[model samples]
Target chain A: MATERTRVMGLFDTEGQTASAIRGLRNDGYTLERVHGPIPSHVVADALALPKSRVGWFTLAGGITGFFCGFLLAAFTATRWHLIVGGKPIVALVPFVIVGFEFTILFAVFGNVLGLISQARLPRFGPVTPYDPRLTGHKFGVLASCETARKNDLFRFLEAKGAEIKADEGGQP
Target chain B: MTETALTYQTVDDTVLATLRPPEKSYWIAVALLFAGILMGAGCWLYQILTGIGVGGQNNPVHWGTYLINFVFWVGIAHSGTLISAILHLFRAGWRNPIARAAETMTVFAVCTAGLYPFVHLGRVWMVYYMLPIPSQRTLWPNFTSPLMFDVVAISTYLTVSSLFWYTGMLPDLAIIRDRAKGTRRKIFAILSLGWTGEFEQWRHYTRGYLFFAALATPLVISVHSVVSWDFALGVVPGWHTTIFAPYFVAGAIHSGLAMVITLMIPLRKIFHYEQIITIGVLEMVAKTIVFTGLIVGFAYGTEVFIAWYSHNIVEMETFRWRAFGDYALEYWIMVVCNTVIPLLFLFKGVRTHLKWLFVISIFVNIGMWYERFVIIIGSVAHDFIPHTWGLYRPSLVEFGIMIGSFCLFFFLFVLFVKHLPSVSMTEIKEALPTGGGHGN
Candidate 1:
């Protein structure tokens, strides 16, 4: 049987505290596994050296797709339909622009939504280990994967930095 | 941590706590809204009791104030979603206190706006004919028609926005549920759908909320564009321009933001959310209104320029009539109110001053409504033949229904602020440096 690796999770009561702890942990060669907070904290992200989110890339793609689709709808309707009335031009680019612009915004927004969902990995119905309910109200938690031998050291460091030890539940098999 | 030392200085709490139930001012506003609703009801009743003749709808001017108000309300609905969803997507922190309230306005305004088409139909019962349903009559709604597009667009917006608004309320409802002691607790508990503030639940809720916001963002743009298409798709003189989509959208945001400021000013004062909805937030929103107003003003200018540059006789004549014809007063008022009044917001003092911003917002709303009225009635009233060119006079019923819509919007908003948590508690708490954990 393989020995299970221990992971350390530190819960802080404040964003500033979590941020500083993250920086200190990073400087000491610890890698952060995940962060759970009530809201996003850029400072914490910066400390953890997380990369620029792919959400923006997804949103941009969505927006571009929406824009083109909108343009096509308008262009096709006005030009291809041959709904000529009086002596007016069969396909007018000017009027089509409005519809095109609208579609651009529409598609871009769709991209943003889709990107967020895919990036966030939402709607997982399987049961997972529960976190402290108080985390919803005010807690900021930092989870770190560590070797079994270094677990005690990480715990001691977090405790010295005013972090409360939370559950040591392992990842789902 | 000392409980007494924590600042409980949010303006909403102070104002709401002190607001006596139904004061003279409250009664006056309510009475006015009720009167407008009743008058509209009377107009609707008369239309049902008799026919659709009471509100002047001649040959050319088939659409009247009912459609104008519908477009106007739909435009009004756009701002709330824009402010809530767009701002949220960008991670604008200031929207925390007012997003939910703004969303509520969006939902109610959309509901009111949705009614105009049915009212315009003399036989309101035939509304089902507009739906994409197969019947014994073997009639199908023309999907090509802009009106059908409106039904789809508006319905989509309403459905998505309602979901967005309700999803946002879930967490807050849970808070209320925990706080309540009696029957209210049970009601909140059920409404909360058994939300337990568990980490996994929040994880899903947040993701779900973000997804909905993203979904709602496009609907905001598409809904209004489709509304604009109702006219732009037509070959009618001034209405046939391509600029109508962006022009209409800009105008919608302009008026919508103005209405938001108008509602928030009174609400903040009434509810005492000064700390939560600070002067800074009001100023920020006012600045956005100014930017949108400027875009709308530019669009207005471009439309006039394009009309002349295109050199199309009918289009040119439409522009001429809009500027110097029968409804010149309405046009000028729109120019002055929508374009000029918002220009005052460029001043730092005006933007920061809540009272001034509030007054400006009201004027902006009034101006935008007139702009729609001018666009719809102006083009429709006068067309290719001078012989068919006529005027539209909105009867008392038309006027009543328009005012009634405003009442409906306000009534829903007022009720929402009182019962529901007006501010996003979780979001606001997150903004605090301490993550709001200091309280415990």
Candidate 2:
């Protein structure tokens, strides 16, 4: 069945009010689109049932790659031209460890950044409609897509939890 | 209102006020800094035209004021990452008010420090030779060189710190975007990359921030250690010591803490951020300085004590020259400024007294610079061979260039506070006793 999903955004003055409203909506089987606020919230995440982030895997992968790259680069350059100073070995890993450590961090940071952009769909262009500027300040915003027929029911439920309805319009799921 | 009483609105208003167009004194200061830059640049040009000899880097004292300035500036860059990254990992709430300022210092100090290598290299254009790129004969830069570690570590430090600083500022930039109008609004919106504070975005952001802090913590310690290795790997009597790594790291953080106190005091007074960056916070920074200061002092004593106890004639002679020779005055100044002076902060009266703290911080800055001078020049000037030893003093050209570096640092900082919110609004808001605290 092709049921319409309309966009709705609600603003709450306090974190307590937003947490409860989101929790209530979730318990009633409504899937939330996203919540916007000035800060991250563990309470809201719990309510939304989001999984743990996968950014660490990316960082770990990048770190391993960075270390190997640093080592190989040094080893390659070192063997390409053999010049021994003070009778020391040309391809020593002890000195390369510093290079490896530096690269490990450098790449980990890069991977972490890439994970953020990819996982979060960042650099989002165009205005995300129904957004209030106050959401960046003290206000907490709850965005959801609801069945067009029950928009009023969602509104009443949110208003019951002390939310200010900022937007109620048709939008894609 | 107290910190707990602060609402998001007041925090935004307070930080945003610092961004407003400034008084005449600001323009005057900016103009003076610009002139100082020009003078420094002019002197650098003079050096380039007249050959490197004008800087007074001679046979024994080949490493002169330029190396000292480089190490000093790099050391200045340390505590910023220590406070921002390490404290974030530890969840020390005290770092909240001043972390933004400190992180900014790291970026600018690195930028300033990066310049000296070029200045020191009379043939500045040959800098690529220091990189890993293959030369005409396809010789890669020797990775075993401590200088190689410096190249990689410092560039890495600059890149990571910049990324960390910007990522933390994203939400705060969004706050400004909403509050702004016209062109400013459009500019901030783009800078913020259209951040709307979605929960998913925040989730990824917080996790990424944790990862950055984690990566940066080790990088900070490693960078200074690498810098110390630049000297430690050498066979110079004073430079080559196993203690050099930890000793340099402690002194770096020590000088860096004093610099934070120096910058933040006037910043608070001028920007009226006393409410946000309270004197209590400054005292906490001072308290940290006490710990780092003691480490620095202990390192100084250990150096001399080890020199005497080791009974290595060269090391012993180096110490004797450092404390009682031609450069003894510089050594005493270093001890007095870095060690004895910071001890004053142990007293509450001195720590809380703004004027006293500022004056002491200035002396510490001077003292730390001289400590570098005493270490580099003192050892190099009077090394093993008696006939090759000679005293080297900095020419006026070197002093001019040094003055320019300081002006460049302050100039960047002054411009920074004006353009961006010196205090992170979102972080401050998160630190409030409100729910949904992200621990930014």
Candidate 3:
């Protein structure tokens, strides 16, 4: 195994405290490895300044692909065998639009799901850092990674912002 | 308690506890549902061995109980999307507790509904011929056929809804993984996709959820409309109406809302989620039921009025037969159960009273099933030619399959509640006072 990276986690009960704590950590040149909360909050997100997710573009791309594919498939199959029933035209736009619309939804949803997994970088191999499970329930947790020499400084930094620090010394429980 | 009063920890503890291994009653229910599934499977196998002739399907009445059950199940699946996706978009706060179960119901109901077309096929093995793929035989299913549209629409609905359900559950599953031990922890770890509630993950997850909801909203409307066109595109007097699309969509949501209520009541009791799935939630669902029931009522009345005004002999005769025909008893019962009984929900008392609401929901489900039956069997039994008019009755085999389908639906739901968080943990926590208001 690689040498363990020192990690210190702080649990805060309020979103405002967590936000200020995150800002404090960032201002001091300490990067926040991760922040966990019971819910997604705009206050926290704004504090962290998260990058915009590109899922909508994925959906748009999937929809366009689906639209043309649906129309072409319908058109191609209609003309493939060339069934001359009552001498009607081979490619009918009106009826085929239904298929196109259904596929738009189908593939757009597919793209959205795929975009989530890819963008979130999901199905990760293991826990990314030391995390408190209570953050998922009612509390806000912030994990800060640093050198063992700077661990004491990080602890004082978190405590000043009204947070309870969990000193997970060796990075592993 | 109002959402504003609860803390995040309280919501987390309450919702996560439901994932525990259920009690003896759950096992007993599972066993019963398993038996029903087995019985259904046995009946299906018997049909396969003997032939499709075992069911009550023949010449003019070839579409029988299987199709009726299919439409009913599909309709029952609609409310999941209605509650989860549509309400989410509209930012309905009360939907927080009920959304998970409703979305789960959507997937399983669609699964149950998807089985019927195969069961109706005389040669079940050759059912794959319906696929658009090419085979050794140069045969391709006609995309123009409504049956083909149904296949694509239903499959898409299933895929998208399942994805939506899985996406919402990721955070909850991670919490379970953290709390669990041994084999259970390992399983949830894999299922949770190593979710850590990292800020980036949350960012992408919310975006994906919104887009999923947007995609699913249209699907909820289109899937049932496609199912309706399976009948509407036909030349049959009653089946060919233009209003059938919206009419079917309304009926689908109405029936689906009833099913959600039916499932939620027992679940809330069993899981001790009374605080979360409060009477207030049930009331909201009940009010929607009344609204949808009125739409369905309007559709019913419109159909009758159109039949009277069209002066088309076939349409007029079919309408007359529906009221006083051989299946008139079912028609009247459908009217009473669907249109009249739902009106009781307009009163706050009946809507909030658990026992009365549960009873009314069951009746609504039965009425909705009967409505499909009346629409399907009634029109086919009495068509354009009086001489060819026929009466159809279901055999024990058909009855077995229908019972089996209900068993299958409940069974999947039971399994879901046992394994996953039945209510959304993240959402409920977001609805708490400490968090922001109803974090839509």
Candidate 4:
């Protein structure tokens, strides 16, 4: 026998109300598969208890790389090229320090950007489920995937929390 | 009707309503800017007809007003990027009202700064020689050269900053589009790019914005550092120093923020953004000015110390000449304007008072321009060889061009304010207190 999964979504009148329903479901140990809200709400993330993001760590790594790259470029230009000038030292460490510092900052900033894009899994271009156009304007929704056997219980729980259940028809809800 | 009045009173919507309408002063500013633009164009034509020789560029003093104005414009440009990108990253709410205006200044200032090197070039038509392209003539730009590095750095900075500015304006443009009636609506609709506040769109838009800001913060630092390297990488006594990069960057920010404050004081009054751009924001920016001023002051001290400690007679004499010799008046003026004026900002009363802050900002800008002049022309005027030393004075053409650059800057800013929303409405609305609680 194979376990079956059922997806249920509850539409609420407001962001605050939908957040409450999500919170209630999460407290009862039902994993929230997704959330579609009128606007961004931190409550959904809090209910899910998502782990700390690694974007900062990635930015830090990029910064370090930038610093080293800057240092190397300056060092190489001044020392390896050996462009002697007026009996002054061929490789002046002092002047080259500026380039090194500049490159370090440049690389670090780029790294942070790259990290943010990749980590966010952004530029998403996938098929989106058709939702009420008005939902985006001023409505909130709670979407969750659960065991097929528990569909009736979940429906009852959501209805009890004042969520309006819309029937799924031909893959459209 | 009485109930509605009671609700309005309870809701505290009066503050928004009480915001003064856009006044006649903005029109006067617009007129002045237009005049400036005309003057600048007239001067530029004069420069073109007579040639670069009309301005003050003699032997040994190869760079003059053009380069000084270039650095000044570039320094002024930094404030916008700093306020927009860096403050956004840090989630500084106070940046909401003025970020757009500041970013626009950055773009126009960069455009004006970009013209200087070409104008300085005796053969302006050979400007393409700076680009890395295969041509009939075998003249490849030296990639290692600091001047070449400046070409790359400035172009990159300009490109990135413009992208950042335009992208940031998109959402606000949409707001303006919806609120606008008739022709303005049509214009804004096109600029808004069909933004409908869709969730997925917002997600991508915000992510892209954040990514650009992150990319821009360091680019700002690098661009100025590269500009400093143009001086620092040389064998000149005053120019060749390790500290020049940071010193120049700090000085740039100091001047840039001062310019921003100077512009904003008048704008806030004219645009009726008194409530939005509060005393708190001005104080915060003033603090940044003071901080950068201290860094600049320290760099000055360090330069003197290094000159004396190195025991290089030429270097020591250069420092002496800058401080106590013929240019002593200029040097002391730089110190008084840059260092002493900023010290008044330490007092809360002065910082909070917009009028005082505005006056001080002017002094700071003047001091910063002198600072660049001191570094570039001062060092060149009194170099290692005594017989080669000479004084540089700008001719009428040079003065006209300098004034023209100011006109160009003001012209762009005025047009930007009239056509576009000077304040970021969406960002400002987002920051407004939701339930009558003061937002920190």
Candidate whose DockQ is highest: 2
* lDDT for each residue of candidate 2 in B390-439, tens digit (9 for 90 to 100): 99999999999999999999999999999998898877776777553322
User: What's each prediction's TM-score?
Assistant: 0.76, 0.96, 0.95, 0.76
Candidate no. 4 TM-score: 0.76
Q: How close is candidate 3 to the true structure, as a TM-score?
A: 0.95
Q: What value of lDDT does candidate 2 attain over all alpha carbons? A: 0.87
- How many pairs of residues collide in each model? 13, 0, 0, 3
Candidate 1: Cα lDDT at B435: 39
Interface RMSD of candidate number 2: 4.2
Native contacts kept, each candidate:
0.09, 0.74, 0.59, 0.02
Give one digit per residue, the lDDT tens place, for model 2 in A25-78. 888767688798887866666766677888888888889999998888888888
DockQ of each candidate relative to the true complex? 0.11, 0.58, 0.50, 0.09
Over 4 Å off, model 4: A1-18, A21-173, B1-28, B430-440
Candidates arranged by lDDT, highest first: 2, 3, 1, 4
lDDT of 3 by residue, B256-321 (tens): 999999999999998888888999999999999999999999999999999999988899999999
Looking at candidate 1, what is the lDDT of residue B375? Answer: 94
- Candidate 3, residue B243: how far the Cα is off, in Å: 0.3
Candidate 1: C-alpha lDDT:
0.73
lDDT by residue (A72-158, candidate 3, tens digit) is 877777776777668767787766787888889989988898888899897786545466655555668898877777878988999
- Chain A of candidate 2 gets a TM-score of 0.90
For model 1, residues A1-173, the per-residue Cα lDDT tens digits are 87556767788876678888888787777767667654555556556555544666665686678667655655554453366667766555555554455555555555655664465553333333434444444566777766777888889889887899887663211
